[model samples]
Target: MTLDLYRADLGGRTREWLALHPDERRRRSVQACATKDVEALWSLTEAHLSLYGGSGLLASPHTFSAYRTGIRQFSQYAETQALNLLRLTPDDAQAYVLALLAQGRKIATVRGKVASASALYKALRWAGATDTAPFVGVRVPKDHEHPLTKNPPYSAAVLRRVLGVVEERLLSACGRERERLLRARTLLLLLAHTGLRIQEALDLTWEEVHLDEDEPFLTVRSGKGRKSREVYLSDRLVMALRLDRTLPRRRSHTAGMVLPFRTRAAAAKLLKPLFERVDEQGRVRSDWRGCHAFRKQTGTRLYEALHDFAAVAEVLGHADINTTRAYVRVGGRRAGKVMRDW
Candidate 1:
């Protein structure tokens, strides 16, 4: 993958993959021991990851990591059964599903694990690394899990409290400190209003940010599925973006990149204080915390205001509308309205 499509999940594998001669990689796959088979498949997975990463078809780093975790777990299963990669059968796939279910993982979580395994097999088959796609047409149970129930959105009051501190800091600080604080505030506001994923925002370049336009918006390039979308700027968020642009240069970088923060961890490091403050003040609810709450909040508000699932889905950069639906909370107001006849 080129720089724009590269994901942190693949890490150093990209270099490793590039180092291998193309003909050697394909030739080596023909004579595979269990270890060699797995290695070859993994190398091919990395290659596809680059393609998918470029198109934004891949999920977050955590999701990519989950795929690797599933592969590792499957490898363990293979070893215990004395089965090579090609020897994996439909029965083995069933056993894996049963084992995951037996572990009492939530149905949704188990589904993800199974899906990851399935993806590995599918990729292997496509790359000619394996003879068969073992998990093909395997029956996986549907999960009734609600998205809103998982990472429950923060209440308006809590979100306000969390963002309010950043706003205050931006307005009050001076010199380089003010610039630092401004960047943090801008990042928070972008997450809050836009519903862009953490990676997509960090991947932004100056060319994508339109501050002076009649309708200000951020051109989100690295959205999921590689689908680029425009996140319309809110009046307040527009102000934040403008202020952030005005700040003194903090780090040297190539042209077009928006934030000086290089990685997801860097961005998270800058927001740790805000998250901690929310934790200290008891503003964060049972399970909700950090930047994701802003995304959920954005989803909830936009869905409620526009009353259009597709609109919200588009804004959130979800390839599937159902994915966007999960981020929206079914608040009491909507429930109450439905029960209004009573």
Candidate 2:
């Protein structure tokens, strides 16, 4: 089983899986754990998670996945220099920032890398990975907040095609696969209209969706730090959502958000499996694809249709208007135009 894929949800599961290996005994020594500075590395990572009060990030797959990947990159960078987190001097952190600058990276880009490293230190301290903080002198400034600006909202036509693909699969698929496809289709369709994040969509429960009255809407009880919001559901969504609500759920007893394929990491494992199942039973390259792509896809579509930054921001639920504004800043003006293409 891909227990490691669920480390954020169930932390000890990965450790349990790793303990099963025959070589685990040899690898468990404290010296080996810290050899080449891995201990120091883990220490910093724990600290980062703690400082942010990462319950939001942990529950939100998009941010959590990015944190894991970003921290891994930072760890590798430190490895190249044979530096340990416990002994991570301010000079080392400063030099890393300078390296990004030398490479002609923008200040925003450089800040992300540094902030990631600092976050590691926070998580590490919380986890008791380190007895003391590694970065005492280096102060982590408030994170640079900006909106997603490059990807325009999806146009009516592109939204049609994306939903069209999902609708096609729902009819053609069979059994559990068919059911799963239907759920995914429903999710994509809802996002195209409502501007809900994928995580928010996944968190839906039957009780939360109200359609008995003339007006229909879903109550998002908690999202990204337990904030609640009410989104009026489109008539089409209110009707279509009933399909999955009737099916037997794996965990929930009633109608709910139907993305029941698996954990967020399910796609990472399924990319190859799905292709193999229908093809010549051969392996396909598992590109870094996930559900987040669909979220971005729909968001861009909405941006195009509305053409108003505030409208896009409201749909996206960006705490700061600037964060929603970032969709335009993504690649460039040319890229923004391209996103508007059907």
Candidate 3:
């Protein structure tokens, strides 16, 4: 452990009587850091969490797995720096960027490095290296290439059909797997319908969902830049959540977190491939579609249905609406033409 930010902690299992606790599950990520040396071990854990913590690329489901590629790339460039701590200066940062460039990394790949590296410097400063910032004067070079698009949200009909099939499969699942699958399906739909980042959706609990109304919304304690927002849910989605949550949650397994899946990693594993089984042509696609693609698809819908950037941004939990707008420019139009106008 290296962060020591968690108050009460355990691995593999939480305290007695706290089973099925969604809060404890969300807390588990910080708990892994319960034994960490926060000040000294500033690079790996601190830098990684900051990027995913919603600080810079706020509301993005930033997995360290998504980042490992960049770290490995930077390490190769680190050898080019001849013994300088990779976190010490712009020279190191620039060299790393050049290495990525020389390797023909995409702009998105390079952007990840810039964001991750900046977080590392901030973490170093947070760890008391106040005089240093490895990113001073460094910048993400303007990407003159094609703009990045939001993966269009699934069509209303596709969203309906896939969910219907997955729910059928879920209800028919035998034994304990049912509850787990149910939780995963519920969370997956919630992610797509509401446009929550994976971390925000992962942090949900039965309590945060208000099922009393025809339309339900989830209230999440926002991480990343420390902002929270209330996200609305569709009526159909709300009914699904209300019905599924009616089960006496397995008290022996939960530790106060909202949903069944605890960590983002666990949620990622549990929730992916649930409903994204269909492709754009209404055909059964591969099972590789992830939680993020759902969020992206939601953005796609906003561009088509409302054509409002702010609405799409609000749904996706982005601090800046431009982030949502960019998606419309890049991906949503194609999605619109392909999905409906065609």
Candidate 4:
């Protein structure tokens, strides 16, 4: 069952779980696992994730969704083996890893699946549900490929072509079509220049956008880890936003979302046709990654120009420099230039 359905079955009991004393919750969790009560066990797992996970802060909705996906997959494997998930041994964890590999799952996929199971067990243990550390030392195969080879950033030519198409479409359209095209163009430029995550950009409000200041910037109130950060605007993005302001919107200037669409799906629906258009070479580029390619392109260009991980991380609002490093690609042209100097 999906996590939401499970919660729905629990109904008011979900609130009860939160209201219970810590000791009572632990006792109930241990009893639930002993009796193999799947529902109660799941409740305890959810409670732990809601409270104790994410370094003691409430975990984000995205975190809960990811864990739900991982746990659901692992539960399916357990059903096939007639294995009690809470009572698993170290061998069971190892066998599951092997089973995933035998099914031809990538190393990264296997690792993600295993990590979710590990997190589930960790939550159970935190609630005194079980002492069985099944996932301990359960190794996943390492990927030998370089990180840069995966999810390569969009090229400058592609970014220019996409914006060009959007502008071209704007010139011929009127009314609603013109409004949508304008929002699409502004959204594309914002993603390409600011390196904001798709959700972050969608969540922006007019109040957070500072366009009249000496150096234009926007405040991301709640980013990945519920942390806030300021991202300075590019001149191109500033001009686009200024032009976008002239469009008739339902929302007021001081309040409501800056973007017309509230969800990624809506934004994608409006922008997908632009990506599907054939290029000058008569080849349809099928590798378009929606808004993410723009974010990656921003990261790549920033790193290319600055050669500083810290600067890129700050722009991208990444807490970890290591994560920022993965977004950069050192092309052959830059490598050749460095060698020429030698």
TM-scores of the candidates in the order shown: 0.76, 0.62, 0.66, 0.81
Query: By descending lDDT, how would the candidates be arranged?
Result: 4, 1, 3, 2
**Candidate 1 stretches greater than 4 Å from native:** 1-27, 30-33, 36-40, 48-66, 80-82, 104-106, 126-129, 168-179, 248-255, 277-290, 318-323, 337-342
lDDT of 1 by residue, 79-168 (tens): 777776666788888888888888887777777777767776655554465677778777767876676676677677766876777777
Off by over 4 Å in 2: 1-65, 98-112, 123-153, 168-173, 250-257, 267-312, 328-342
Model 1 TM-score (2 dp): 0.76
Q: For residues 1-342, what per-residue lDDT tens digits would candidate 3 score against the true structure?
A: 574333242221112213324454324323322323233233333343544454532433445445544444444455455534423566767767777778788767788877655664454343343346666677657776544332334456766776676678876797777777667667767777787777776666667777775555777765455566778888767766876766555555664556765567787677556545655788976544556667767777767788678877766767887677655553544677788945
- Candidates in order have lDDT scores of 0.72, 0.57, 0.59, 0.78
Per-residue error for 77 in candidate 3, Å, reads 4.8
TM-score of 2: 0.62
TM-score of predicted structure 4: 0.81
Model 4 lDDT tens row, 1-342: 655323443334456677777788778876765555645656666666656566433344445566667777787788778887668999999999999999999888899888888877987787666788999899987898765566677789877887898888888999988888888888888888899988888888878889999999999865788678899998988988988878776755424677876667877887787777665899776547767777778998998899898999998999999988778877676889999999
The 10-residue segment with the lowest total lDDT in model 1: 50-59
lDDT of 2 by residue, 1-342 (tens): 553434443344334333444343223322322563444344334323533555723456555556565567666777778777556777887777766678777666666666666666665444444554444455334435543432234445545654665676767778988876666557656665676765676667767788786788778754676667777777778777877677667765333455555354553343323222222567454222344444555556566666677766666666677766555433465577898995
